[model samples]
Target chain A: MSNNTAIKIENLSKMYRLGQIGTGSLGQDLNRFYAKLRGKEDPYSIIGQTNDRTSEAESDFVWALKGINFEVKQGEVLGVIGKNGAGKSTLLKLISQITAPTTGAIKAKGRIASLLEVGTGMHPEMTARENIFLNGAILGMTKKEIKAKFDEIIDFAGCQMYIETPIKRFSSGMRVRLGFAVAAFLEPEILIVDEVLAVGDAEFQKKAIGKMKEVSNGGERTVLFVSHNMGSIKTLCNRAIVLEHGKLVYDGTAEDGVSYYLNNQNNASEKNLLQRTDRIGNGKLKFTGIKMLNKKNKSVNEIIAGDPVKFNIDYKTNCDIDVNKLLFGITFWDQHENKILGYSTDEMGITFSNLKNEGYFTLNIPCFGLRGGTYNIKLIATVGGTKMENMLDNIENAYSMTVLPGDFWQTGKANRSGNMALLKGSISQHNE
Target chain B: MNKDEDWDIILKPKRNLLDINLKQIYQYRDLLFLFVKRDIITTYKQTILGPIWFFVQPILTMVIYVFIFGKVAKISTDDIPQPLFYISGIIMWNYFSSCFSLTANTFTGNAGIFGKVFFPRLIVPLSQITSNLIKFCIQFILFLIVFFYYLNSNAITPSYLIVLLPVLILIIAVLGLGLGLIFSSLTTKYKDLKFLMQFGIQLLMYATPVIYPLSTIPAQYQFWFKLNPLTHVIETFKTAFLGSGQFSLTGLLYSCIFTTFTLIIGVIIFNKTEQNFMDTV
Candidate 1:
């Protein structure tokens, strides 16, 4: 590893056995122990050797993270972007020494502190003052050092009045603020943050991002940040790593990685629509597939800020069911679980008369004025007030679709205020 | 990389083993002191009696033992006054029991904090032991009051063995901590062990000669009594203060050897468990 490289991860892989859960048995423990003692590779190393699909899929290990290699230099701020279950948290946990990696090695320099979650080490009965020290100790800070910085931490958290009050009395925001304040002030050589900034308000978030920038710019520390906000990723990160299905899909400049992630998200939604049955659910009545197309009947993942789009849902009913009283609704939620828009057949004044066989339905809406961002479409099918199938289908990132710069609104800013863009109109003044 | 500039002191945790960094632990000693202070201060902050609970608990337990075992059961205190004898045993026993009980639940109790941060896990149990020692100190003073009152009345005389009180207390603390850690590690995997721990500690007090004098046990049962390391610790305490119980140097040696051995094993198991206990716990 180069001297400038703050972190070096080599062939890092993490495999968790599928269905062979509960920390494994004593026999399996001994088997693994003896295998390590004999210098043999993990008995479960052979990826597909234990694959037995018929017998409840035994003897197979799921690679939560696979053969990942990367280097982070001093003062570098790297963003780790991945979908849920993509092993982002696992990677941080391994680096922070919360858990050991099952395979490979990670070499890192400096005192590393990770804010994996907020209010992690806070004791409810302990006062804010006591918890500050307790939390400092848990983060590996010495008492003398914490004492030296105590006033600063309390001031930053803005909870000095309640220093002697138990933390249980603090609001969630206060708890998060205090937690972030401590972690940020720890001043470690390397900091790893995992989506914890999303906990606080926008003002605190801006402050935290600013602090992260300061920490990295100081030229002595490095940072690894993970967030789903592409805008923040683009603004905060110098480099970025993209993970897809437990694999390193891309690693490069922040712009390129963000673009790659957006493009991959586009493809994933398309692929998931094609293979919708594989999505986990009751599996009795299923949303077999879904497709969104433009007026030209072309399958388009991208659309203008205001344009016409058509949604087609292909579903199968296990048994004959009533169609007249059936309800088909679709809700669009942003990546952060923010609901942007929703519509149902009842609200649209469209209803099916009678249906006995499995089929497809198409809903078309014109002049959809959704702003640029990724949005998930949740399709719910209910009959006789009993819900059957509900699936959140990804329709390209609605918001991330590029909007040309010169319309009525200025395009220099990356994000526009409010929920969605509104048509702009102006009344002209005439002088005679 | 310049080796001299690099401050990489943390070692990767050894697999399938409990590893401790004594140096890093020492480096964080100030944090430990703060944690101990936090424990002591926050424990009494909202309570009515506050620090007096520390004194009241042992005194009340000694009074109850005096009522049930001395007056009701007519158990002999080996010709020693009931209050002084019971107070001595109660103080020492309460300290050991509290240490073991608290240490046994260390991992479970602190899982929330442990899951979030990376620190020497040993600091938690160490702080608990230290904090409990504060309580023990208060109760020990109360025990001293009873001892002096009896001495002033010419009812009992302390022996030269009283010099061994501190050493005996150290042995008892280590024994409690060791066994507590072992049980705590086990409880992470089997939650049922926690229930057993509460009942088991109470049952162990009966086996240890806390309420009854060691001399009261029949001669044939002496070997079995000696098998209990805590028995020797209690007997040593009684002999040191009340000056009536038997004091065998060989028994003290045996207890010391057992305490050391249990502690070593406890440290090993505890180190191993701390690594991935977050998962199981």
Candidate 2:
């Protein structure tokens, strides 16, 4: 570990046993004890090893993170972006000392405070004033320092009415605001933040992101931020680390990392669509295939956000049905799993008539008015209030579209917070 | 920047198998003081009787013990007045029992906060111990009032051993904290232990010298009685406050050793458990 390097992780690995549930057997425990007694490395540290005596299992362990090697320089803000369950949270937990890695050593230079969940130490029974001190203590802040920053924290949180009120009485937003304020004021040498910024409303989120930017710019502190929000990651992080299935797939510039993440989602549509049963809901109903074609009937993976788009769903309803409601819903969710907009056939008054058996349905929309981002389509067929077919295909990313820069309202902005953009009409005033 | 200096404090990380950092704990002493204050203030904040409940609880427990053990069972109060005898033991035992029960559920009770951040996880238990100590001090004052009133009423004379009261209280605190941490760590894995902890403290009070004097038990059971370190602690507390009670330097020495050993082991296990206890907990 070099002094300039804020964090140095050497061949770090974490493996979790699948179903040999509970702690391992007494024999295995004794074996481990003996191994340690003899100064031998843990035998079970081998990847995919199982020590179950009765069962000759193929593989009993899943590596949450495997052989992750990286060096973070002092004062660098490194963004970690990955798909859900890609071991992002696990890595943060390991570094924050919340959990120990199964193997490897992680060495860091200074005091580390992880705002994995803001206000983590806030007690509902305690007043905001009391909880601030409690939260500060939990974040490793001395009492004197917390006292000095108390007024500033309350001002930043923007909650003045009930500092003495129990946190249980505070609204969810207030709690999050206070929590974030305490964490933001901590000023630890190293700050590890998970996707906690998604907790508050748009205004608070903007404030939080601004605070994060300020903290990173302080020049002596290092930050490891993990978020699926590409726009925020792009704006704040100088470098990015991308993980795929516990592997460090990409590590370099933030732009390349975002593009790499987007490209991975793009390629997923091909191989992932064929494995439709696994991708969609529990195998209650199976979507055999989904295809998007243009007016020329050629397969197109990308589309303009406001352009005419056609969706064809080939699904098999396994059960006999009556009063079946074939619900075709398109959910436009951002990379961070925030639902931007969702439209269903029922919501649109475009429900299909009676269908006797399982077959294919071709749904066409004249104009899909979504901003540029990856969207998912969920196809469901229910009979008599019982769902017979429900399929969610993320491989196609449902629909990958790009809304180009235009005179469109808020075109230059990265995030379109509003549900929809209305066409503008200007009135000229002639004054004497 | 030299890498050696960067990772200096962490590399050979203090073998704090007893991961409780006394220095770091001292650093957060204000937080601990506030937590104690919070517990005491909140306990009586909206109560009709307010701080009077502190006096009421032990006085009431002493009355019941005097009735059952003193009058009915014909048990000796070690020549001390029965109320003073029972109240002294009750105050000390109340502190231990409350501290033990509270500390035992530390992780389960604070799971929300524990999962959210990383602190010297020992802070919760330390704060709990300190807070219970404050409550103990309040009740001890009440006990002193009762002691002085009895003395003025020509009932009993206070002993010089009363000077040992602080040492006796310290022993009880350490013993309770040690046992509490051990049980709290175990409870994270075995939830059934929580149910036992609730009832276990009350049951263990019978085994200790809480209601009856140490001489009441048969000589054959004396070894078993001594096995419970708390029996020695309670006996010594009574010996220190009430004039006529017995004091065994040997017993106090045994308890001090037991408390130290248990505390060391508790810290070691607690340190290890806090690292990844969240997974199982």
Candidate 3:
């Protein structure tokens, strides 16, 4: 580990046991111990599959990560991107030494601090001033070092008024401010942050992003950032890696890596939305097919703002049932799992109370107004009743859509702000 | 020791079964202090009685024991005043029990912090030991006050072996910490061990001669009770502080060896379990 290489991982893999303490718990461990004495391969390790959240698990063993190999150089910022359960967090966990890998090794130099989540180790009962020292020490800072930066941390967190008050009395926003302040100011040789910007309000997110950029560009220590926000990744990271199903799919410059991950990854899984076992609903009705199309009815991965995008939901009913109150709805959620907008058949006063068979429903937005980012589509099919079995189908994260930047205003300028949604507005020129 | 920066710490497919990395623990000493401070501070916050609760627990338990065991059960204290003898026993027994249970819950209780960050992991149990030590020190002062009163009244005599006060305390602390670490590590894999821990410590107190003198257990059963490592520590504590109980030099030596062995085995099992206990816990 020279000064040039900050972290080096080779053949790193993590296997997780499914269920709790019944089968393949201690018995398999003893068996593995006996086999190792005879110089044989681990009997339990041979049956693990890659970490995929969808699909039925075959055995009690699953590989949360496998065959992972990467090297991060000193003073370089690396971004890790992957779909949910693609082993992004697991990889960071291994690198941070929170949990040891099952079958490989990770070697790194200097002190490493990981901010896996906001307010990670902050004690709720301690005062803000005291918690600063505790969180700093947790990240490997000495008492004298934290004292030197005490004023700076207090000023940065902007909790000067309540320094002596316990943090449980502070609002959640104030707590995040203090937590992020301590984490960013610890000044370790290596920093690992996972979705930290997802916390706090919009203004705080902007400030946190700016601080992250300055920290990554300091040219003194390395940084590893993991987030679902493509914009931040492109702006802050110099290099990036895309992981799919616990395997490294792409590794390159930040721009190309994000582009490849967004464009090509998860295409097959997205196409087979209904086959995924992650959904819950009655077996009477289920989603059969779903697709997104451009104005020309051509299938596309993304659509520009102000364009007419079409969503078609194909359905199949198992038996003839209540058609008078049947409902087909689609909800849009941003990458952060925040619900953006929703549209439903019942809410629109459209009655599907007629006889139905295998058919499809089309929902067309006049302009398809949504911000330029990937959004998750949740399919909600139900009957109008409060009964326990009224739900026909509720498949969350069934499909995804990507909206691109467009000049909706026709002013020869695009929307440069990071607003959550786009709108088509009419303006009348008038002097007040 | 190899100083090549190529691998400051190499994590392999399988860890050495008994590698208690003392250097790593030393490196994270700052974290240990911080955790100890957190444990001490956060425990008393928001309560009206505050830290008074720490003193109240053992003092109140001693008063009840004096009333029930000394007055009701007619147990022998070897002719010494009842409260003085019972208070000393309660103080020592309380420290060991609190330290044992607190450190034993290390893996299960702090799984949130342990899952998100990585340090030496030993810092948690070490902090538990130190924080409980602070509590024990405060309670010990109370015991000293009672002892001074009994001495002025000529109710008891002090032994020359009172010089071994620190040794007796050290052995009990180590025994508690060691047993706590072992239970904590094992419970992560088999949660049923936790239930046993809850009741076992209570039963173990009776077996250790905390409420009664060892001489009262009858000569036939004396050797059986002496087999408990804690029996020697508490017996020695009473004999040294008040000069009223048996003080066998060989029993103390046996306890010294047993405490060392438990601590060593405890640390090895703890270090091994901390690596992957998160997956199971």
Candidate 4:
């Protein structure tokens, strides 16, 4: 290991047993023990399957993390991007020493602090001042050091008046504020944060992201951030990796890793909607395929801010049900997961009485009034007419489109970027 | 890369079961102090009696023991006044039991914090031992008040072995800590062990010479009673305090050996369990 390498992990793997914990697990543990005593390979290693949390694991043991190899340089902010159950958290847990890996070693140059979850050791019955000490202790800081940083942490968290009060009385946002404040001030040589920023409100998230940026840039500290949110990853991380099924499949710059992750969504659409794993619905009826269509009805991956477009939602109802109470809708979100537009069949006051068990619905837009950005579409289906009782289906990020500026008004151009909605109006001035 | 000879720390899987890593404990001494404060302060928070409950518990237990053992059960305290003798035994036993039960819940109770952060996990068990000592001291004041009253009345004579009070307390502590460590590790995977421990610990009080002197035991049951290591510590404690009851170096040595071996085994098992208890717990 060179001096510039802040952290080095080699062949790290963790296997977790299934079914009743600690009962049958003791047998497996003993097996490994006797195997090691005989200088043989790990006995359970052959039966371990890759971690795929969304599916029913095929074996009695699953490798939560397997064959992970990586090296982080000094002052590097590495983003870890993965879908649910992709072993991102497992990697962080191993490196943080929250648990031991079944195999391999991790060597680092300096202290490592992990904010795996905010307010990790914070006691609800203890005062915030005291919890600061507790949290600091868990983060491997001395009481003297916490005392020195006391005022700064409080001022940063903006909970000075309630510092003496028990943390149970504080709102969740305040708890996260104080939690992040303590973590940011530690200034450890390596910081590992795992999806904790999502707990805070928007303003606190921004502040936390900025603080993380400072931690990586100012003190020559390496950081590993695991988040499903690609936008923040792009904003703060210089390099990134993509993990899928307990394997490091892609390693590159942050921009490339994000693109690689987002591009995987294309394969889901190719597999058809009913087969997609990342969805929840009653399955009474389902969307077969959804695509963005241009004015000429040609499917396009990218659309413009202005000009006409339509969403062709092809549906095939499997079982017989009342078609009149059914409603179709789509919600669009900008790059930052902010809702930009929501359109529904109810808004148009149209209920088709002649709908069949197998057909398609085309949502036509006279003018696509969205500013320049990448927007994702969520498909929704509801039943029970105006009562809207049953939510038959709701798929998030089902289809994504990149919108650019186009000629809308007589000014010959539309907006360039960063606006949620576009409006159309003409101001008529007379004797001004 | 060549085992990283230049690195500061290398984290690997446990190679030995007895890697207690006392240096790590020494490095995190401040955490131990903070946890001690947390336990002591939080124990009384939001309660009406607050710190007074600390004194009331042993006093009330002593009163009940006096009524049952001294009056009704007709157990002899070796001619020592009933209240003073019962109070001393109750405080000592209370300290040991408290240490055991508190540390027994260490892994399961702190699983939330343990899952999220990494520190010297032993700090939790050690802090339990220390915090229970604080409660022991508070109740010791009650034992002292009764001791002084009986001393003025010429009921008993204080032995020179009274100076060995710290040693007796240390043995009791180590015994409690050892048993607690063993139970905590077991209860992580065998959650039913916690409930069993509660019932088992309560029954164990009768086995030790707490309310009655070992001399009260019949000749047939003396060997079995001596088999309980706490019997020695408690008998020696009474002999050291009131200048009565049996006192022998061999018995004390047996207790010491039992305590040391139990503690070593407890620590080894505890260190092993802590590494991955988050998974099973």
DockQ values for all predictions? 0.31, 0.30, 0.34, 0.51
Instruction: List model 3 lDDT by residue over A1-432, tens digit each.
Output: 345787788899999887765444678778888999999998878998877778898877898888988888889999999888889998888888888899778877788888887567888899999899888888778888989999999999998999999999999889889988888787888889898665678778777877887898788888999987665677678999999988898999987886677556445432555576776678688887788867767556666566687888888887556888887789999878898888978768888755566777788987877767788899988787535488887888878777765555555333433437766668689988
| Model 4 / residue B1 / CA error / Å | 5.7
In model 1, the runs with Cα more than 4 Å from the true position are A17-24, A30-61, A266-268, A271-418, A422-432, B1-18
For chain B alone, what TM-score does every candidate structure achieve against the true structure?
A: 0.94, 0.91, 0.96, 0.96
* Residue A10, model 2, lDDT: 74
Q: Where does candidate 4 stray beyond 4 Å?
A: A26-42, A265-267, A271-288, A291-432, B1-3
Task: List, residue by residue over A226-249, the lDDT tens digit for candidate 1.
Answer: 987666676678899998767888
lDDT against true structure, model 3:
0.83
Better of 1 and 3 by DockQ: 3
Docking class of 4: medium
CA-lDDT, candidates in order: 0.75, 0.73, 0.83, 0.83
Q: What are the C-alpha RMSDs, in order, of all predicted structures? A: 8.6, 8.7, 8.4, 8.1
DockQ of 1: 0.31
lDDT of candidate 4 over A106-219, digit per residue (tens): 888888989887778787899999999988887899989999999999999999999899999998889889988898888778889888665566588668767877786674
Predicted model with the maximum DockQ: 4
